[model samples]
Every structure is written in structure tokens, then in C-alpha cells.
Target: MRGHDRFNTSLPDDLIIEIFRRLDSKSKRDACSLVCHRWLRLHRLTRSSLKIGASGSPDRFLQILSTRFPNVTDIYVDERFAISPPPCIQGRKRSRDNSKVSSEESCGSVGNVDSPYLSDAGLAVIGNGFPKLEKLNLIWCSNVTSDGLASLARKCTYLKSLDLQGCYVRDQGLAAVGQCCKQLEDLNLRFCEGLTDTGLIELAVGVGKSLKSLGVAACAKITDSSMEAVGSHCGSLENLSLDSEFIHNQGILAVAGGCPHLKVIKLQCINVNDDALKAVGANCLSLMSLALYGFQRFTDKGFFAIGKGSKNLKNLTLSDCYFLSDKGLEAIATGCKELTHLEINGCHNIGTPGLQSVGKSCRHLTELALLYCQRIGDPGLLQIGQGCKYLRTLHLVDCSSIGDEGMCGIASGCKNLKKLHIRRCYEIGNKGIIAVGKHCKLLTDLNIRYCDRVGDEALIAIAEGCSLHYLNVSGCHQIGDAGVIAIARGCPQLCYLDVSVLQNLGDMVMTELAEHCPLLKEIVLSHCRQITDVGLTHLVKSCTMLESCHMVYCSGITSAGVATMVSSCPNIKKVLIEKWKVSQRTKRRAGSVISYFCVEL
Candidate 1:
């Protein structure tokens, strides 16, 4: 028997189906399907999920999906309006086209009508097709109105998770979901401005016992009363997110008093003070993750109360909490020993002393983010590195005072670091990056954006030592073609690279990247003036797997260069080549036409 035949015979059909079911990534499953016909059939039969509505025509996608995967249980229809209609829409007219055209004209004559590609009729078709769908995501489906949502909700009664983010969902649509999807456990209504207290009350009463997670961020109309309804009815609620200027202490107290099982809460730009946080600390006994943002009225007193109450807290994010000082951080450090993930942003008053307290107290801290915290310097990082020896991820964006000494200190202690971002820390030079590259062997993602002093020495060191999958050296003018070549040669697994604004880099870097980094999926070369048609053509031809190429303000590139790249990589979605003012059209052939892509002047 041949190798394929032997392999197929080795594993039984049941075993093959079980093995294929365990594979998570779509790409991996696809590769496995290509092994043989038996595996292909098994893969298709076992697959139960599909995501469309981004590129292909929604109508055609629905027909194909219904025919191919009749047993699909989950569908995510994200019909983005950023680009024009896809290739499947052209030269194909629906039987109802004449009626749609006439109705559109009438609507246009009267007023504005946001006639989205995926209309109410399309949603009805989907509802009829996927009756067994348990999860449905209709994010950014702007044209989908209350009628369409109601139609979908009425049909998909088995839906446990429903995401209508950025949709035109209002009281009526929410009411429909509440009435139909009684088994719904997760609901996200982010950016649904048309929703209000009436809708919330209706939803709370309908899905009160089953609802576990709720997201209402950016829904400006939702008020304190709305939250009160949620707290009163959603007794089983475990996760809640609220944002905007309305939610206050009353709402916080209501939610806390009602939902004792709440484990996660994210409050952003709300008018809640120390009283609200204190309530959460006292009542939310199971709270483990808490995120606070734009709490101008909150002070150290609130954090102190929170720390004392929620001793089991594992994740905390504080952003724009300007009033919080060292005392608050000290309180938290002293109280919450279980804290493993912490992110502090725009807290100007927090310095090395506060960080030291956290480092010393929360020894298990594995993830930390300190953005725009200017008071932190070398000593602070040293303290953190020494105390949090198990640290795995660190992000220090625009912490201008940190230099080589701080980076070296971090490198010595955080040996297990996997991701490090030091954006706009201009004081640090090649030495700091070199230290990290040498010590942090597990680093897969590194961003040194706007660190102009970084040169080939640091890049070469990282390339030699680490196998990074994502690297962004944007605005590091000191790096050139030689540095990129070293990176391509050493780190052959690079998937995303952003070397924008490197004036010295030419097509040579592209050639090297194309030849070595076969896994490169996205490349950003904005303002790379030296890169020309010669280099770009080689890149497109060699790196056929590339999905997106951004080359803004590259004066050397021309219309011909873009044409060559697109013609070769026809599946490429985003090819942003602005500032060069290049636009070219290829002659259309039978049964095929060039897809409309984004091209701005």
C-alpha cells in the first residue's frame, strides 16, 4: 500500500473524527484535509462552524454554507462596510432585483436609507437555514434593523450567545431577543445607541434567570435604572460591562446587591465614586477581575476599600485614575495577594514606590502594563523584576524616563518573559534591546516603536537569539536593509513585520523577507521611500501567502508596481498604497474580474 493508504488504514473512522474534532485552528484543519480523501470527508463532516460576510457575497456564502455544512451550529456574520461589494456581487442579479431597485429609488427620493448588503431578507434566509445555531455574531451589520433582528431571534431559539454590536438594535429588537432566546447566556450590545432603559427592563425580565454575561458599553441611553433592572433580575449574572457618562454609585450598588455571584466587572468613564467601588468590594465576594477607567471622582479611599474587600482579585486594570497615588497601590498590594495581572495607564502620580509595594506584595504577578507612567524609572523596574520573578508579559509605552539600566534589570529577573513592548522609550538604546534579546529567549512579540536610537546591533542580536513571530521597529531610522536581512535570515518564523519610515531600506529587504519568511502574512512599509517596483514585485511573487501590504508615502512605488503585486497575489485583501497616487485597472476576462480594493489618493 502507498503511504496515504497505509496512514488511512492505520486510524479508524471514529478515531479520525475524534482527532479532527480536537483541532482548533481552521488553517490546521484545512491542511489535514489535504492529506487524503478520507481525511477530507471526515474534516468536512466534523466541522460545525463557519464565518463569512467579510469578503464573499453574503447571498452566495449562505447558499454554499447551507449545501456544504448542513449541521453547522455556530455562525459569525460580520459584514464590514469599510470596503465596497465583493466579487460575488457583480454580474449576478437576484430574482427580486427589480423590486429592490424600485424600492431603493423610492426610499432614496424620500430620505436617506442605509441599504446594507446583508438585508432583512438575507437574515431571514440565514435564520431558516441555521435553525440549530447556538451562537450568532452580527457585529457591524449596520443595515440590520429591528425587523431583521426580530426575524433572526424568532427563528434561532437555540442561541446561547448573541452579539449585536454596532447594529441598529433598539427596544423592539432587544425585546424580541429576550422573548425568543430564553436560553441566552451571553449578550453584547456595544454601540447600540438606540437602546434605552425600556429595552433593558424588558430584557432583564425575559432572560433574567439565564443571562450570565452582559455588555452595554457605548450605549449612551442606558441609565442607572437600567442597571438596577439587570441587578434585580439577573441574579445569575457573573460578568457585566458598563460605560459612558451615566452609570453612578446607585447603579453600582444595585448591581452588587443583586448579583452576589458576579466575578468580572468593567466600568469605563462612569460618574461612580469611592462609594460605588466600596459597594463592589463589600458585596461582590466572588469578584476576581475588575477594570476601572476615567474615574476622576475616585480617590485612594476607593481603592483601599476595594483591596480590603476583594482579597481574591486576580486581574485589575486602572486607566485615567488620576487621583490614585502610591497609597492606593500600597493598599491593593497589601490586600490582594492573588493578583497576577495588573495594568495601570495614565496614572501620573504612581511612581517607583507604588510599583515596589506591588512587586513586593504581589509576588505572583505574571502580566503588567504601565503606560505613560513617567514617575517610574530604573529603580522601580528593578524592584518589580526582583519581586515578580515569574513575570511573563510587560508593556511600557511612553514611559520616557526608563533607560538601558531599567531594561537590563528587567531582563536579569524576568527570564520567562514572552512579550515585551517598549514604545517611545527614547532614552533606551541598542544596549537595552540587546540585553532583552539575550536573556528573554521565549519572546515571540516585541515592539520598539519610535526608539530612533535602535540600530542593526539590537536587531541582529534579537534575530540571532529569538524566534519572534511579531516585530515592529517602526520609526527606528537607524535600522536599514542589512538589519532586516539579518532578521529575515535568523527569525524565519516572522508572521507580522512593521518597518515603516526606514528611509534607507530598499527592495533588497523585501527580497530577503520574501525568500526567508514564508509565514509572513502582513507587512507595513509606510514612508519607505527607497523601496521600488523591483523589490515590491519580487516580494509579491515570492511571498504568495501575504494577505495585506501597506506602503503609504513610498514615492518610489508606481501604478505599475501595484498592478504587478495585485495581479500576482489576487487573494490579497488590503493593499494600501496611498500618497503615491497610484491607481490602475486590469482588463477583465470572461467569468473573472478584478475585485474592488481600497485605494485612496
Candidate 2:
């Protein structure tokens, strides 16, 4: 109906637009679009967002997206990927069974850290389809090569945020991305293995100046030269993660010199020496959060530099920096008055004196991790409890020297403790754990991994008092079947549990778990030989929602048993049975079990 002829539309233009925008799912929009010819012509030409999903209808979905949504601004995909196989010997031959395994699975053929194939190539295709695309996320798509990523950068002109996590793209891809996506703000290459010195140089030349946030974590190929390039080029960089063994004094110096406006920096597993640390302390004056885990060469000079420069530091970590002593910690305690989260895990030189300094000065400290700090005893723990009243999360894993007194003090003082990890602290007997569990009612996650003293009683107390959603009592050899069963009954909201080495678990615990937590999707019973066909039978029958079950080394499983469970659980995606085969009858029960396996252990 024409406007002059009194067009008989009931809704106003704005209302119509709002209604059109409310359609989120692509299938719904497509259904609406296909209803009539007039509806398609009347709707807005440009799509508000682009979601090219590979979940339901990959072919039709991409087709509609490419053809209809040409001006789409946002692009999101399920980047479930895998990597290629490494070079094998010339004469090596894989058997017919191995070929079956390879043919069934399209990605992650050799168990590369990230899913194998989906990232770069997938992004390239998506990019080619949507030239005006703004955001791209390629998580765990290791199969993506630099060529595919480069194609994306070259094609997608208006790209802003790009996440290439666990992808195989190197410097060439980064260089291309930097050059083409000039408007890029956030670039994440976390765990991208192929990036090296020359590639980093190319990257610096391309997008370093325009970048606000960049993550180069676990990029082992990067050295001091590339780091210097990053620091010099990306002076406005706010967040930087340099987790590499090669990044030493020179690389850190470059960062300090270039990115003075930085607020967050992570040097996890770095090899920075004293001079480099001093450079960081002196230059990055506006530092707020810093992580320096495993920088073994850290010394008093670095501390002094930090003490003088980052006087307003809020969060600091000196995890595994063994050379850092009480004097250095005292400097930090004295200097950074606003510090709230302090982690000195495995810093052996920081004894009671260091703890005293932290306790006396950092009143606002909420999260403290002193894991494996063997020198820190009850004296330090007492001091922490007495002074740091606001402490919420304490990680004392492997700090066996600090016994019941420390735990008792913590129980009394830190009433707000939510997450506690006393893993491997054999000295933290049942009484100490119980005392903490009794007091800390707000506990949502607890990890007593390798804590032999922790028994069924401790778990019972945890279940009774705390609302734990995540629990890991892995390697706690002392905890028997009764204790695990109590945990199943107690923690109703438990979503993630890792009781990998608990040998006592059997059919009863499985029954309780299945009955209590119907949402049980992932169960890792590795090394628990006691779990037999009966327990699996109960689990398969009850928890139909189970997605991934890891029953490796549970020799009790026979071919027939696995076959029965697999056939019954239609929703079961992946089941790990490293060394057993199912019977013909069980195989008969399976409709398409061949598609759900990655056989090589």
C-alpha cells in the first residue's frame, strides 16, 4: 500500500525495525524471510550482525550469510579445529585400523594442543564472504596456516578484534593482519607457535603503533629482538603478555622504554634477569597488575627498582622467583601500599620475615598464593592471618612446613575465604581442613590435590558447610570410596571435579553421582582401576546427559561393557576406552559410534 494511498501497515517504521532486530537465530530469520516475497523487500538491507555457525547447517548458513548479509559487521563461528600430523619416517606405515581413526576425525589427528584445522582457513573463507566484517575469533583452530590468516587480513578491511588462540599462524599472518586491518584494536595470538624474530619485526611495522591490547603468550619462537620491536612500535600498548623462555633483560627493557602507559603485564615463565626487571620497574610507572612467574634470576635490585617506580602498584606476583628474599619483599610491602593480590609461590628466599612485611603493610591483600614456598612456616602464616583480615583466597599447596597452626589461624581470621588450595600440603591434617571448612561457609571451590592427610571427613565437612561448584581432590591417596561418595552427596552444584588418582571409587559412587548430579557431563576416572563395568553401567543408564567420559586405565572395562554404555547414551559425544573393544551385540546396538572416536592413546 502506497503512503498517499493509505498504506495499511499496522506498525510504525521504528517499531518494525525493532521487531526485525529482535530476530537473533538465523534459522528463524530465514524462515520469516522465506514466508513471502514482500517481507524480504520491506526488511532492512544490511544485517546487524553476522554469525556463520558450523553447528547446525554449515553449508546453507554460510551460503545465506555470503549472499544476503554482504554488509554484516560481526562474524562469529564455532572454531572447533585440529592440526596436521608431524613428519613420519619414509618407510613407516599406518595399519588399516589407524586409517579408520584418521578418516573418521577431520581435525586434531595427532593430539596437537589446539583443535587442528578450523582456524585460519575457516577464517579466510569467512573473511572472503564478509569483507566488511569487524570481529573474528578463531579459538583452538590449529589447522589454520599463515596463508589462510593472511588472506583474512588482506580481505577484511574493517576488522577490529581478532583472536587466533592456539592457531599455527606465524609472523606472516600477523604482518598481513596488521597491514590490512588498520582499525584493529585488540589482537590475540596466544599460543601461536610459528611467530619468530623476523615475523615480529614485520608485525611491529604493520600494526604495533595502532594496537591498544596485544597478547603474545607462549610464543616460544620470539626473542629479545622481536620484543624490542614490540616495545618501540607499540608505545600506546596497555596490555602485554610475554610468556617465553627467551625474553630476558633486553626484551623487558624494550617494553619499559616503549609502553609506559601499560596497566597490565604478564611475564609468566619468562627468563628476565635483574637488569631487565629494573628496566620494567623504572619505566612502567603506571603498572597496576603484573605477573612474574618463574623468573628465577630476580634479585634485590629488581625489587628496589619496582619499589621505587611502581609505588602505586595494585597487584603483584613473584611466583617461583627464588632469588627474591625478605629484604626485597619488604621493599615491595613498603612501596606498593595499594597492593591487594600478592603471589610469592615457590620463592624460597622469602621466609617468615617476608610474610611479616606483607602482613604488616598490605592490609587490602585478598588473594595470596605461597605454593611450594618451603621456607615459609607457621610464623608467616600467623602473621598473614593477624594482619591481612581481607584475605579471601589462599593457595598454600606444598607449603608443608606450615601445619595446623597456620590453617587454624586462617580459619579464624579469613572468614571470607571462598577458594582454598592446600594441595600436597601433607602437614594440613584432617583437623585443619575441617576447621577451615567449618568456618569458611562462602567456599565455592576447593583443591586439596595430593594432600594425603585429607580424608572422607574433610570432604564431608566441605559438602556440609560450603557450596562448592568446583572441587579437585586429585592424588589425595588417603581419601577412600566413602569420602568420594560423601562428596557426590554433599556438593550438589558441583560442575567440575578431578579425582583422577583416587583408586577407591566404584559403582556406588557412580550411582550417587548419576542420581545426584544429572548434569554430569565430564567424568575423568583415569588411573582409578577399581571402576568396573557395573559403575559404568549405572552411569550410562542414569546420566544420559554425559558428553565426555575419560575411563582410561580402568582395566575392568571389557568390549561388551563399553559397547552397552555407548549404545545406551545417545548424547555421548566422546568416550575414552584406551584399551578395550566392544562386542558384536553392543556394536549392533550402536547406530553410528564410529563417528565419536579418536582412538590413539
Best by lDDT: 1
Give the distance in Å from residue 342's predicted Cα in candidate 1 to where it truly belongs. 1.7
Give the per-residue lDDT digits (tens) of candidate 2, residues 1-601.
3444232256555654456668887677667666455456435343657543234223223443466657677765544622223222112344677543332232212222223234443555577778878887767655568888888788887888888777777777788887787788788778888887887678776777677787777787878898788888888888887777767778878888998988888876456678877887888899898888777677888888888899779898877787889999999898887889988877888888888898888888899988788888887887888888888999887786888888888887888888888777878878888888798889887888888778888888777788777788888888877877777787777766777888877778888887786666667777787878888888778777777666667777667668767877767776666533645565566634433334665
Worst 10 residues of 1 by lDDT: 105-114
List the pairs of residues colliding in candidate 1. none
Q: Please provide, for model 1 over 395-444, each residue's C-alpha lDDT reduced to its tens digit, 9 standing for 90 to 100.
A: 98999888998888888889999999878989989998899889989989
Q: Candidate 2 has which clashing residue pairs, if any?
A: 81-115, 81-116, 82-108, 82-115, 82-116, 82-117, 83-116, 116-143, 559-581, 559-582
Question: CA lDDT of each candidate?
Answer: 0.83, 0.74
